[model samples]
Target chain A: MKKVLSGNEAFARAAYEAGVGVVSSYPGTPSTEITEHVSEYTEIYTEWATNEKVATEVAIGASLGGKRSMTCMKHVGLNVASDPIMTLSYTGVNAGMVVIVADDPNMYSSQNEQDSRHYARFGKIPMFEPCDSSEAKQFTKDAFALSEEFCTPFYIRSCTRVSHTQTVVDLVDRVEGPAFAPENNIPKWVMIPVNARRRHKLVEHRTELLTELAEGDKYNKVTMRDKSVGVVCAGVAYNYVREVNPEASTLKLDMVWPLPIEKIRKFSESVDKLYVIEELDPFFETEIKAAGIKVEKLERSLCGELSVDAVRALFNGEEYEVESDNSLPFRPPNMCPGCSHRGMFYAINRLKLFVTGDIGCYTLGLLPPLQAINTTVCMGASIGMGHGLDKAAEGMSEKAVAVIGDSTFLHTGINSLINTVYNKGNSTVIILDNGITGMTGHQPNAGTGCDIHGGNTPKIDYVNLIKSIGVKPDNIRVVDPFDVTACMETLKEETAKKEPSVIITNKPCIFADRTVIDAPYFIKEDKCSGCKICTRLGCPAILWDGEKRVAFIDETLCTGCHLCIKVCKFGAIEQRSK
Target chain B: MKLDILMVGVGGQGTVLSSNIVCDVALANGFDVKKSEIHGMAQRGGSVVTHIRVDEEVFSPTIPAKSADIVVSFERMEFLRYADYYGDNTTLILNTQVIAPPSVGDGSAEYTDDKVEEVKKQFSKVYATDAISKAIELGNPKIAGMIILGILAKAVHFKKEAWEQAIKDRVPPKTIDLNMKAFDLGYNI
Candidate 1:
């Protein structure tokens, strides 16, 4: 059967067809839907792990228990799972294990554009890259065969361009592969110094064998068109290269890592001019050059994504424009109009506190109206950084605080929160529990009381969780962030305390929680005192008519939450009656 | 045989949903289709764009600049932002709706009043619709994208049944009637 599916859906379908018994992932953009789609298949037991590290570990345990297991994450997520992944390469697997990592080339929703192929090389694992949805499905299925063949973890990399793109894919029936029984092999399973040292040699030998297999693999193929220019590309870049210059001879490598060394050399010798067409970093170009092949570098920036026009320009012997802006007004992502974080951030800025922000929708607080955040290193860095900053300076503890989302706090903030209490750091932490992971399209978290399968799970009580971490019950404050006056009062009270404290900003994301009714708020022009205080909240619903000098709310956008109404002391903004 | 479409709109405007419907309709009609979309933070009121290409055989998910056969814009400014995607050969189906960006609304910049006129002058076939107003007339603002699809249905030679089926397949069961009505309004307009 032929079906139109996104690369993510195709990947999940392919995993099911490959007889994958266990699938685990933490929700991240371009990668979240893979796990979500997999959850639809009852044949495959799937989960959204607290973080990528735990996801990788769960998949590893499943693989060791003789089931085909896979874990998925974005490029930055591989950084979190690198510890286990590096060792898993030595331990190998009882059943085939595939770690699917989606890279965002343009940093679409990610913090960085680090290549996942580098992780494959670092861990001594084979990596596959697919150009379209069909290949995404086919390569994913092939990944299992490659994993079990070498008894090593295999990486299947998808970029935002690949994962989010929809294309035609041919569906296949699910294959029932032989399941291995868990055998207690002490030398192979145990990673003690002696065992690890011997396994490391096998890891090296396995890479060599994988490279030999890749040399003749169907994924690494050559298309001879014009012998003058031979371009080597992978993943989405391969599509760009093919579309732009179909006449150019091409060496397309679906198996990116443990590269086809012999085929690359043959292709390099056959063509007059060899070029590497890839987005972001020159991963293929650097490696092909190291393999002693003479290649010409296409004049393109390593930053951002490669467009079809960019590749076409290179093929047509024209210089691609470095910068071409039509002067469109910038539309950076902002906090939603009725977002609870806006009130909490507005309070943070009013108090002039240095806040270490974590990854989530709240990180948007670093933008113009509420420039409240000082640092945003990574996930769970907010609490750890808050403790460090407070200890570094004498009075910084009084002025500095940490803000993290419910999902992110659950991912890594719990450990850091426990550290603050254990180390006796007096840093104030704010857990912005928006109920779901808002940034990644509202995936259910531990606090959301729903699993990946949408089954009702026990919700994590933030107040109790904080108390268990050794903060006093009195010190842990639960406040409705939508109530600006009350939220500000709580913020002031908590920062004044000498002991460590937490203020949980409890509210659900308006978009995610459909139960939240949004009665339109209209501005009373008669009572308007053009103070522009409500405008400072940066609510998209609150529009200031420059001519009238009075603010009016766009009824369609205004959620009856009415944080703007509380900020308006002049009785300007009022919610209309139901 | 090739129809390259570039759909641009603000996040939460159902731009992704519209593109998905078009792709599905094309697939149902036996055309090879590929579409590239942006989701995530962009879903939070940022500019969202999708490049959808359909033909007898489609290779790339993205459409080349200055080569789109048709440009379906849900918002006016976002359409102008991607003006590079269309040329003289391109037919523009613009939803005459403007949701000013923060910079423009804050007096830092100006919203171009002559955008429709400007686009008309550049592209030969420019169909501007008051889809936002049309959607409001139909009693729901969320059906604005469906109205654009109605206009697009006229520009392209696809079966109305296929388009309707695609909409039904993609949208929530409850909103199917409203979306079909919105699509009909757009088709007529």
Candidate 2:
């Protein structure tokens, strides 16, 4: 009964094992795979909802029906689902509804590094963060129980490390949990103002009690060692604190919000110094400090994301250090070789249009060579922000295009597009339909023609959807982005029109769908031209060997999608003749 | 002894089965072993790493990085992540694969082949090897991670029979004969 599981898969197995009857999720990184993993078990009903808010509401309804249900989304997706999340916290729940939210700390596969721990505070729900896959599984199984026990939705928060990292998880959680079903009660389920007002009190009463229960819950544990430095840490930070001062008496919290106040105070008093080591936010530290406990030093530097090295830097004892700085080295994530986004960025940049980008792998379009996108606010904001920027300029500053992924458009971009249509404002929204949601690890979206858990769902035609959203059908054009010339004409046409227009670049994610292209192609170094044209595609596989003064393609990384080949005017990007 | 070791590597390598053998041995040795894996974007040739920790009273699942005694990385390019969990006491088994991150693209930044050597200078005790070449020599070429895992076992007290049993237990029953040989060759390495 032992195996390896990533934090995402472990959550899925935990869902299955928890006897979860309903699993709904909007696929986002560090979160998308949870339901996909849960789907493996035939006992559970799992579906990839079109968007995060819809997924959350679906799960909420399931939970109200007396069956344990769960929904998962990335941190940004949480923003899309925030409306439901905030109110549901007031309505409370029945058979335990768990929401697994995966956060990106370094913005890997995410638009921003908004801390979900703060969200737990905002949503007024208990948030559990597991540092590794094991904790991910255990916490998920524990999440269902805690949700029902408190009669409120429980949050299992995950960071990129915890979500992406594979750890030794005891894989039995999938088979251990029992399927739960609850009896329907309209008075209990309905959230109308009259019933809601009573449920709000119930929610408040539960919150007040949950805070006190945190003091003795099994979720938080204390280990006493030297007792000189009592460090309060949770999630991955706990692992770091344990390593930094293994001898330091520690209070580790798995349930971050509604912190175990009494336990933190006792541990702080017992130890000589108090250092709360949690990631990103000052949640635990602030909570404990508010309880009137004075500490020797508040390690604020431990805020943001903490690597074991950062933690050990504070503790001089045999720390893990890479000696020489060198920025600790970072890999610049780039678009795969044949990325569909590349050809589009080429056109957008060549036209010198001030493009507003949305969250997706395509956001890499802003990187070095391309340097095209002017602004990247958040998910689904491209269209609205683009409209505002364009209207403010009033045709003074060239063409402004809002570039969003198909997944994002479906997530929340439609409303803004509708507003542009209703107001009769001119904003061209280009929906990059890469078939799969690329940024957050290629989770299926409404536009992907596939549902969560591999079900064949009706694909939302971005062109038709926008047309229905009030934009004229003629204003919406489905253009094959692989053809640069066709894209150029469409781009000009969409921008030239003084009305809301949508241009969906229809193509499968070349990396996800390998059949899109085959056989590796590279830039001919001997051609003696570093026009910097191919680099404009912003493909990660293409690198410049500064010493050699030529474009170097990492053959292993290239998908040969031919988007780069099409853009290289010099015939430099020729297909490798095997 | 029961060992729950997470072996991490890129997709083309044998990260799955190598860790499975380690987990299976712990199970066969009657040490209630429970191991799980999440293979996300694995097919995309991205950074792949594992967490395998074997202990007696292992309650919480993750190894907690610094708590890990050994971190076997199939590609040296991903060694930076090891700094999170790898401590002065941890042993590093790395493959000399020079696959660059997505950052080192056409216009973003530049990197040379010597990047792998530049990274090795950062580690505490580096065991570098041409695992791909060794795997090719093993007739499979894909079990490069297994060869690296083989080199890792040299530092730990894992029994050969347990590993053999794990390979036979975890792999498809059809490919058992070949995979067992692959595991044995890895064990010898």
Question: If you assessed candidate 2 against the hidden native complex, which CAPRI class would it receive?
Answer: acceptable
Per-residue lDDT for A113 in model 1?
80
The digit string of per-residue lDDT tens for model 1 on B1-189 reads 899999988887878778889988999999999999988878888888899999998878888878899988788767777767887799989888988787665545667767656666788688898888988888988788889999999889889999999999989999999998999988887
lDDT of 2 by residue, B63-132 (tens): 5545556767777656565555655566667777766554554444444446656655654666778777
Which residue pairs overlap in candidate 1's backbone?
Answer: none
lDDT of 2 at A58: 93
Residue range A1-578, candidate 2, lDDT tens digits:
66666678888888888888888887776677777778888888888777888989999888877778899888888988889988889877777889988877655455567877887888789888887777888888888888888878999888777776555666664443334556566666677889888877877788788888677857688888896778888887776676456688878788887777888878877888888777776777677778898755543453345665566655543433334335433444556667787777778877888888887777777776677788888778898998888778879224889999887787778888888888778888888888887755666777776766556878776666776788888888888877887888889988998888888887788745767777777778888388776665666677676677778676766676777667676777777775
Best by the DockQ measure: 1
lDDT of 1 by residue, A264-321 (tens): 9899899999998888878888888898989886677788888788888877778776
Best by the lDDT measure: 1
Minimal lDDT window, size 10, model 1 chain A: A320-329
Candidate 2 similarity to native, TM-score: 0.84
Give the TM-score, chain B only, in order for the candidates: 0.94, 0.78
